[model samples]
Target chain A: MTGRHDPYVRLLRWYPKAWRDANGAVWVDTLREQSEAEGWSRPSRGEAVAAVVNGLGTRLDARAAAQLALGGIAVRAAVEVTMQIASPGGISVQDPALNGLVWIFLSAFAIPVFGGLVALSRSYGVLSPRRALAVLAAGAVGICLFAAAMWASAYGFQLADDNPALARVASAAIPLGAAALAIGATAGWLVVDGMLSRTRLRRLPRAALSLVAGVVLAGLAGYATMMTLGWVTVGVTVVGLSMRSLGGWSSVEPRVVVRSRLSLVRTLAGISAAISMLGIGYAVTAPAWSPLAENPTTAVVHAILVLLVGALPLVVALGLLAPRPRLHVWGPVALVLVAMAATFYGYTDAPLSTRIDSSVPIGSLALGLSLAWWVTARLATSRGDRLMAGIAITLACVVWHLAALLPVAVFVLPLVAGVLAVRGTLARREPIQAVRTAPVTDR
Target chain B: MATPLTPSAFWILTVLASGRRHGYDILSQTRTASDGRVSLKVATLYAALDRLETDGAIRADGDEIVDGRARRYYVLTDAGASRLEYEATAMAHAAKAAQRHLATRPALLTLAPVIR
Candidate 1:
């Protein structure tokens, strides 16, 4: 016969060590007593399972978050430095090569700083505006240091054939990158602040959440096919997204007793942010030297195209999840669509006789629309809302794909539908403001 | 405002209301107090206890070892007492309303005749 404490100990292992150290003994004794009273030598199966589930739901420790964030940043920085040092023909060229290294070094500043921010956010859910602003300031400072390092290398190291043009571009790109990061972080903080301040919905419609999930998943799948990979990748991505969405939807509703899953979600979010940052880094460094040096216009266009292909999906996902701008959220989206069209026109016409990939712009637009649909699903607190969003995304993807056979003008229908769907959601009578929950008492 | 306590949490609190009680004592008291209406699994009991302790509704009093196993005792706090009082008052009012409605109802509306 198993000792009464053995099964309890095994179950308790799921909890954080800090928690276990404080209450483990009491819990173990309680289990033994209860089992004896019930005439059992071992813990019941139901209780054991509940304990494991409860443990998984606990928020991540601040120390663990800090370590993950710092570790992820270090890895990113190492990858960037290695890639720079190992570039073709080495650093002997001095002019372009050193400039490239400077830019790479400057960009590396984002990794650790971002990791620290993620760790802090994990410790404190939904950072206050002041703290968010502070984080932005810290990020800016890191960027400045990156620039300063670059400037120091530019001035201090004597390299043969110093290139003024590459140096200027590097100088400009660092500030731009920093500004983008600041704007994005600030926007995200404000959204989180708003969401945290408002009443969170206790019960969401399962069908609705699932439907929205389907659209998001399908959009991600379509995006993979259109932008980066083949049908095989698309199938895999769709299946994964669907499974994840189903898992989230079917899980027990968020309970008043404990927001057990918050920590796990936060950890995953931090990891996703790090991965997205790597994608951004690759996008920034993707431009080939020959084309970039030959025609600046082509270089800019290519860089933008690459970003559209590589970085836009993640950006769209983040943007959808974040707070919307007061400009009806459609104004900027409309402008982007117009710009995409103009880019497509240029790709086909090519005033400078440069070959542009037709798929890049179209794929980005399709993927972006799908991501937007997915984001709208977040708003589905009721039964049918997710279903509506999911439907819109699916239709939009279909329309976008139809452009291959039909006129590209058909794509506008999906955009209009998306805008209308969002507008309808906004027009709804105000949702019952959910009461603020007290901080969870136990893990 | 404090939400109504879940049945398990309420039962745990009721057992702890009298005096400091170790986990086993409280578990046994709950089963007896409710006349076997409520039986909490050990995991559920501890989970609730942990929450109660954090909410300042209960405090750990002391610990002792019995048969080489440590047993920790808990006592209800002032806040917990007040909250429990509030819940009891609310329940009483609800029960009174139900009784009043029952007492006033015209039961023999369509009866053919009296039993006499």
Candidate 2:
């Protein structure tokens, strides 16, 4: 029932819109020409699948150097995880099922996921090398020590069961190694995020980028600090690094007016500040929070923490995937955040100290109020200033749990970071704005 | 320097060596010149064309819309022609040596089995 050109049109759709614009008609004509020559009105199903596979592979493989880089990391992850298990003190896995699961996680997921992310970053290149430099340092250190830890464990297992020397070294190394990989993998993602963000805001004026930074910084200084350590960490890291990037980091980024609605971006910044205040009936709010609440914010903070880590990302991911302005490659970003959430879940099982929880809020409140004033005074418009002043006064009061109520403030981390990672990868590899199309279709 | 070209790029250059050709013509002529040994897919040919153009081995000549089917023409560059010539020479030498080696081999080591 499909038209004569339908199959070819579908095949072309496997590629990018810009690609379709340039070569779609001609390419489809060739497919039709070939099919006609073969006495078939349409391409066989095999060709269609091959075309789809080819398109996805193009996004994944990116380039030969990137392919090698990713391939090496995947192989390295196998070595790292193997060493952890083989080493006596690396991990104490007595349960048979858990032990099997550990091995499976090491072998199956580590290489493909981490290496795949690294490969994804290659297509985007290094948008702002600042954060990448930091993540890379962590990853590189992790790699070296991980290799040492792995070697100690593997050799320790072979020589004797009671090798204290190797056990001591590996026990010290394994967790550090995994955390390093998490950091390293995250670095690739941060670069992907930077490139994606750069692409998304390409059409907006430079002032808008700084304003967006100001608003995110406000959230970091205000609401996000209490509930999200990782969220705050990645946020501060990105803001610090991306400021340079937004200023003109990528030489390759095209200087074209974007198809993006610029007003949409300003709305997004406004939304960030409004969501951070959890001042409503402050019960000390969180691990970091309002000192004025004294003890009342505890239960509310716990609820916010649960909501932030648990339900928020899936909601944010769905929101981000909305049509009209979709991010092409977000799978890796989601994967990294999920890993972070898994780490947070691990920490939850261990009881957190009440002293650190209660004591940190008062100090954080002083910091938050002070920061709110500076941000509002220096950057925001009259409307944004009013919102901040309101949030600030609320932070000073037990009258409202202003910053801690909404989990949406926490969602901003995944929203911004996820959106960044999404677009640099295509549906998508390489930012759509970058000149990086042909290597995939390379015959 | 004479670097080895991919088979698809080689055949494409070979077809373009004759004259400028559009996408469909390049596909058909590549099949013909290779004596049905080589066939290029549409996506692949376009990717190859893009890479070759990027590498300065080929350039777009012009465009024509014939009978509602648009065709973009491409011509091989001097770099492409020279590279094609180098590949052809290398292949020719290898082929000549192979034929010489084949001609020297005996039909049967002991005898022709009295067939003659």
Candidate 3:
């Protein structure tokens, strides 16, 4: 009889092609023999599902796991570098010669990370379009609130002599406002992260099951604990699996080889994370420190930025970098719903600094118009042209920063991209193999 | 590092250690060997078998057809035999250690007169 009558034979489609090629015929024969003797018409649902689940498990070979790790690392490093660019002289390193060239390269804008954000949201938008855009909108609001707080502090300090008590109250409130911003933002990300964790738990790969669990759990837990558990566990588990690569696998399993390669990847990610934390801590704290420690405004902003720097990877690793689930997609749904709930970002990044809000109304309008144009351009352009256009627009954006619209460039660019994505007018997802990842400006 | 085999793997290897067996035979015998407690689905059984063969612990000894069904007979490789022996030895040691610990239990429960 043709194997068509047997459901198990047909179910071989679930196993990967390579596996089916080698073991298909015998495997089918085994199933048939067993089923016939038992007088069963077909394998039960559980049996068929086990086959499929294990079949998918076989696909998570060493290389795919490595790619997963690369994606994780890319997200971590990108945010760090982005933050550093925004808050330069937080370290006050007098590279007088390099300074002009650094400014001239005019490419310190932290756009790619947001590009990654848009990519994640767009490509893996298992959530409905309206819902996802709404979440982006919420993130935008938190950013705007932060910008407003900064503006209030800077302008409040400028007119302090005229209104001393009001200025002190405003300056004192900056840190609290920024903290509230981080907390609100983090809470929003946590809700999304929780859902992503649930999705990951359901479709976990056998090879990386425990490690994936570690990543998800670490994301929900505290940052210091998460760093140890998240980073170290990734390293330990990679080596641990190799050491015990089932049957203490001898030659063929190649866990030993994988262990070495993964360690190399782990080590690289470790160094990158360390540098980012240091730069962020030093640089972000610098802006808040201001040698004018008496400045309550500076003190509060410093505390929050430093905290965010140290704590950001946790937020990002889960919210931005965690793999999208192929099945249920409540993460997008929930994030955008949260976005809708917090939909108060009706303003742009105009109030982020004195340069725009206090001194240069025309510049502020120009900045707003320019960001709008960039978002519109992303929607209109073709793929390759979009990237080229992104680079050009990002350059122009950096020039705008150099031209005195500096402070808003930090998270505002990503915010605009988030807005673009939520509108569903953003460009289609690119093959952002940009495993390369950063720029935060801490000015 | 001589890791212990999983229960299904152990039973599968044990069945093959006795003699060469086909897929269904291995599946059925593993059930018997595991006292029907470790029943394996067909896919799970084959996945384990394939993994064992890949690990050089087992190999297809021969193949033939019976009643129009292919029978791929697999035998335990030297590696498989050694690993199985290692696992059995470790299990024996663990059992002995547990029994010893049980033997050393405090008589605090003696205060309770054998309450069921």
Report the number of the highest-lDDT candidate.
Answer: 1
Chain B TM-score, candidate 1?
0.87
**Which has the higher lDDT value, candidate number 1 or candidate number 3?**
1
Candidate 1's displacement at residue A155, Å, is: 46
TM-score of 3: 0.37
Docking quality category of candidate 3 according to DockQ thresholds: acceptable
Rank by DockQ (best first) = 3, 1, 2
Instruction: Give the Å error, residue B105, model 2.
Output: 3.4
Q: What clash count does candidate 3 reach?
A: 18
Task: Tell me the tens digit of each residue's lDDT in model 3 across A1-443.
Answer: 24655687777777667778877888888877777777888877777777766665454443223233233333333433453467543423343223322321211111122222322332232222222334344433443444345445545554566778767745754674555356435434533543353242333452245345434432332231113123223422332232232123222111111223323433433443454445345445655656843455454334333332332332222223212231212333333222222211212221244223222323333343344333323233334333332333333323233223222232232333333223322224531121212211101
Report the candidate with higher DockQ, 1 versus 3: 3
Best by DockQ: 3
Which pairs clash in model 1?
A57-A260, A208-A386
lDDT of candidate 2 over B1-116, digit per residue (tens): 46567688889999999999999899899999899988877766776787678668999987777777778899999998998898899889999999999889987754766765
Q: What is the lDDT of residue A11 in candidate 2?
A: 76
lDDT of 1 by residue, A1-443 (tens): 13534776777788778777887887877776777767888778877776665554332333433333334334433543364457633355456446545444534434333434433443343443234334444444544444454554454343323655445544554565444444444434443433343232233443344345434433332232223123222222332233233233332223222223233323333443444344344434545444442455454444443333332232232233223332424443443444455355444534353423344335444544544444443442334434433433433333333223212332232332233233321124541122246443222
Off by over 4 Å in 2: A1-5, A61-443, B106-116
* A169-279 per-residue lDDT for model 2 (tens digits): 446546744554454444444444454443323335434554455344333322321231322233222322222222322233222222342223234433432332232
